[model samples]
Target: MQNEKIINYIKNWLDNYLVKTNLNGFVVGVSGGIDSAVTSTLCAMTKQKVLCVEMPIHQDISQVTRAQQHIAWLKSNYNNVSSVEVDLTPTFDAFKQGLPKTNSKREDLALGNSRARLRMTTLYYLAGLHNYLVVGTGNKVEDFGVGFYTKYGDGGVDLSPIADLMKSEVYSLAQTLNIIDVIQNAEPTDGLFGDSRSDEDQLGASYDELEWAMQYEGNPEELSSRQAEVLKIYKSLNSANQHKMKPIPICSIPSEFK
Candidate 1:
């Protein structure tokens, strides 16, 4: 994670995609976590406009402080970083009330995913209004290789700055690139529910371990007992999140393909 090369790549990507798309800057959903911090830092380093937004739901406001910390640090560090606040509790509650009463983990996942979608939809709407692109913060530990993000929810973004970097690699790059310490150290969370439950609590294992298992022990043809479990987890994440990576459907060859 050399600082110079990291900065160069980030700048190159920003120029190639964002500049080519005629976007003024990137609008990011900063959750007061490591991934968003690093992603926002990359955008800042690129000398691009960075909109750091705090879109919280019914969860506790503990993360809001971290968002502010990220904002304060960004104000000092980045040239064009700004922030906005959007509380999504009402939208989430409206959707939750429309659903039937089923209080299960699967049901909770659905509700939480709806909230994530709401946040993403809002981000995109703002992106369109501001002539910006939505910048995604999901890292390799969460999206690639292991693939743990919600379909078309948290994974839907105009650009994913850290999609290829693993969890360990993300932290390494963040430290090398001098991201804010508070954000670099904060526990990763979706904040869909109350009190900020952890990804590991829901995933049954930490992100690094899952990535290691995917890289080393995974064998699609024949797996050992432990490897089977890893494969199962990986496949479950991939299958569940497939919609995020899919292209929107169109009518025919001339219309859609062409």
Candidate 2:
């Protein structure tokens, strides 16, 4: 992809959207990942006031460091870029404590999702206070192909500048935008779990493999065992998370009843 052309297109799109909506500025949560870094950079390029928030809930120290680095980079490079660090650990802890005790993996997954929702809530709060639109950091593969994001959580946003770009495309933009080296080199993670598991660890495949599986349509029998396994995982994840990707099914009333 032509980086310059794409960048200009997105910047123009953001400008037009903000004008149409009459919003003041943009609010984005910086996660220290390539996706967030790229999104924030694009927003900053607009030369409009952009608030980059870092909401960490028992997050890994390294991840927090990377986030700070990216925030510093934004402040230094863009005059309109500002940042704030909100520690959500106490809020998360209270929510987790109120729930009934359970050792099931299902509960673990729910808690992980709750962390994302908390961050989402925080972003909206800032947006409300500042009259800005909440910008999301999900790329095409995670947002559509694997449905990797939490519904109503990380997926909750007013605008997603990189939603159409694939993971590889985001990386290309990151490099072009001169994102911080630490963030560009860091492993991709949701940073919601206590163990700090990478996205690949949770998804059972790398972004490259998952992207290929998303677009691949060939004879399964011709694939190697590992490739087939990856395909199976991809298909299962896509199926399970389809609910998050599709619109909610609304029951229509019959014409006679209406």
Question: Model 1 — TM-score against the truth?
Answer: 0.85
- Candidate 1 stretches with Cα past 4 Å from truth are 100-105, 217-232, 239-258
User: After superposing candidate 2, which stretches have Cα over 4 Å from the reference?
Assistant: none
Q: Write the per-residue lDDT of candidate 2 for residues 54-93, one digit (tens) a residue.
A: 9999989999999999999899999999999999999999
lDDT of 1 by residue, 38-139 (tens): 888788877888888888887667688887788789879877888898888887778778878875768867777788889899899889889999988888
lDDT of 1: 0.79
Evaluate residue 223 in candidate 1 and report its C-alpha lDDT on the 0 to 100 scale.
Answer: 64
The number of the candidate with the highest TM-score is 2
The global Cα lDDT (0 to 1) of model 2 is 0.92
Instruction: Report model 2's TM-score to 2 decimal places.
Output: 0.98
